[model samples]
Target: MSSVWHARCAGLMITSLALFAGTAWSATISHAAAPAAAHSAPAAAAAQPAAPTYQHTASYQAAEAKYNQIRALQVQAFDASECIRKKDCPSDESDMLRPLEQALVLKRALETAASAGDRDAAYFRAKVAAEESARFNEEADIYTGFQDPAYKRSAGLAYERAVRERDFAKNMLVAGAIDLHPWSCMLYADLNMAAQPGVNNRDAAFNAYYCAASGFADRGLKDLALKAYAGMLKTGHPQHPYVLDMHSRLLNVRPDNPWRKIEPSGLVRQPATTSKTSHH
Candidate 1:
């Protein structure tokens, strides 16, 4: 009986070993498939990138920016050529305006593009050219007419008026050249100079005021000049040498202050044959 029991126990142990071997074989097959599946995707990806190349949005903007800058410069050159042909700067020996002159050039380029049926291109060109041109224009306008008495006189007054107004005071001089191109710079200058110290700045202020008031008048800035003149008087620049006799003329012609015969009269009210001021 004991020997029979031992043989039965040995048979049970063999059956358990076979079951464990089958499970181990199955686990090995399953793990091998997982690695193949994971590796296949990477291998395919490494073989080649997707069909369409990738580009970030920054690349697009960068390309556009470069094109606009280069094309705008080209168009600007073309416009300047046209301005040369038109003799817009009549004083120059060449048929062209100053090389730095830009506004007219930009407009000319736009017209050329429009004539060629490239209205969209013309529009974009004008927009870009204007930004570049404005910088030059602002610079020229500021320095352009400084030598002219009208502009200088206006600046003188605007600086003084700005003292009290601090903000609105400059309007006194700018009022004279509302329609002028170069006039705008002096107006801005007048506005800015008002904030400067009055000690060393007084002479300049007086000069600008007189010029703005009188210059605009001569330049046909009639209304603008009148306001500039009035503001100068109110701001205490009326006694400035350039303004003294002129201011007196304006007062004498006034209808409200009892003087009727003098204000509108020219500073030199004598016959046109009066002795001329020295030509410095």
Candidate 2:
């Protein structure tokens, strides 16, 4: 495999593995306890609803198994590529083909399961398609030495398909599923960033930020989540009010706000804009 291909595969694999843990966050809303009259305590307790439960179905389980298999093969391929690069262990290019082939088979299984209304399957299918698109684009870059329009066009078509698959999967998902697969939000964000900017881009960006921020918060990365929300608010998008409201609520609920102490100078800054005359 090419170096670019290896890097992309390794990066994505690490991210997926890190975020795929089965820990579930609370599905019910939490409220602060308040000092109440003794008589009202029992009535307040009775008013709370039971949290809903989620059980993975047989199809979802099967699809998950297949997805795991694909990930394992990808790891093997990535290892082989690294060994070949170092020339420390004998590795053949053919070793990488196994994972690519298995991934395609897994994609088909995921597609079938997704069509049957399996939300997890839909998510996995979208991920597979996105990976395939990345692979195609990287391969095209290598094969053409980054100069061939035809190859780029072919890769672009694959990207379009990946986007469609991602959207389909997103439509099938619920909030709980999104919490379980927070990486999906980041994946969607990447796709939107790559897309040509339009009216939808603003909403898509906000949704991605919101979902990812919630995911981070659920995982107890409150500072990271707060920073994301703050950045969203700074964008001055039409959704600024909503971002501000969320930030305010987060601070209200968590009094030990780290975001207040964070300085703009510590964050990454955008490159300074330049005029055409300055370039000369």
Among these predicted structures, which one has the highest TM-score?
A: 2
Per the 3 Å backbone cut-off, how many clashing residue pairs does candidate 2 have? Answer: 0
lDDT per residue, candidate 1, 183-224, as tens digits?
332343344443444445444444555656665555555566
Off by over 4 Å in 1: 1-12, 28-120, 144-280
- lDDT by residue (54-124, candidate 2, tens digit) is 45558657777888888888888888787777756677778877777876787777777776766667766
Estimate TM-scores for all models: 0.26, 0.46
lDDT for each candidate structure: 0.51, 0.63
Candidate 2 residue pairs in backbone clash: none
